[model samples]
Target: MDLVTLTVDVVIALWVVAVVVGIVRAIKARPPRLAPLPEQIRNRFEVGWERISGRFLYEPQWAVGEADSLVMSLLSARGQPLDHARLPREMQQARHDAAAAANGRPRDKTEAMRQVLLQYRTVFERNLGPKPRRTAPVPRREVA
Candidate 1:
């Protein structure tokens, strides 16, 4: 009823509305979960990974670049953002190291390239790895 009380109530109500709006906006802005990769595409990625790993011993730098490319391809198939900043943190780091190696930067050390390949593997498996099988539940036995 009082002027001071009314002013304080209005401020509190406005603050609450602002907070709710912010939360809703954040929820809407989040990216949707990636759908499962099709079997054919998954198989192709697996074969590519096999070749990359096989070549690692003989050509570490090339293998790392291939691995990064494979992961990016997988992400593309899944409709993920290709922008470096928009990619997942693990992917961004792997991509950075892969670029460095390809450009002959200091991080192009053999051991570092190996680590980059491993990082790419992590992303690859997360997106294309075998999904867990679901077993059917046993039916209940009838009482005698």
Candidate 2:
């Protein structure tokens, strides 16, 4: 019984120490330097901006759908890359599309963003093709 009590006390003490350490770390940690956050967020916009070769825009899944033509049209009106000059409008349209996708039922906004991301991921998979490549079957050799 005494052993159990001592173990419990040690566990509690560990938890308290952990919480204090977390608090100290949080206070001392510096916030990451970032560009000013835009007023709105667009679907897959961030992903595209971050990629080296830019897998976000050219890939199949990230490719805009028929319903998402508004976005493409807007991008076309701007320049090939949809330059940051029109970021505000682009973000607005993205939010509009997000709302349209949600329909009537209330959903988590983050989930909507994730859905948009997944849509692009599907495009990526389609464009990239299956992971394991298929090869032509070889004819069986006859035993000598």
Backbone clashes in each candidate structure, one number apiece?
A: 0, 5
lDDT (Cα atoms) of all candidates against the true structure: 0.84, 0.46
Tell me how far the alpha carbon of residue 4 in candidate 2 is from the true structure, in angstroms, after superposition: 99
* Candidate no. 1 TM-score: 0.71
Clashing residue pairs for model 2: 60-123, 61-120, 61-123, 61-124, 62-120
Which 10 residues in a row give candidate 1 its minimum summed lDDT? Answer: 99-108
Which digits, one per residue and each the tens of the lDDT, describe model 2 over residues 37-111?
Answer: 232333244344345124434542343343244344334433333343433443445545555555534445434
By TM-score, the best candidate is: 1
Top candidate by lDDT: 1
Q: Residue 54 deviation, candidate 1, in Å?
A: 1.4
Q: After superposition, which runs of candidate 1 have C-alpha atoms over 4 Å from their true positions?
A: 1-10, 28-31, 100-108, 131-144
Model 2 bad stretches (over 4 Å): 1-107, 130-133, 136-140
- Judge candidate 2 at residue 55 and give its lDDT: 46
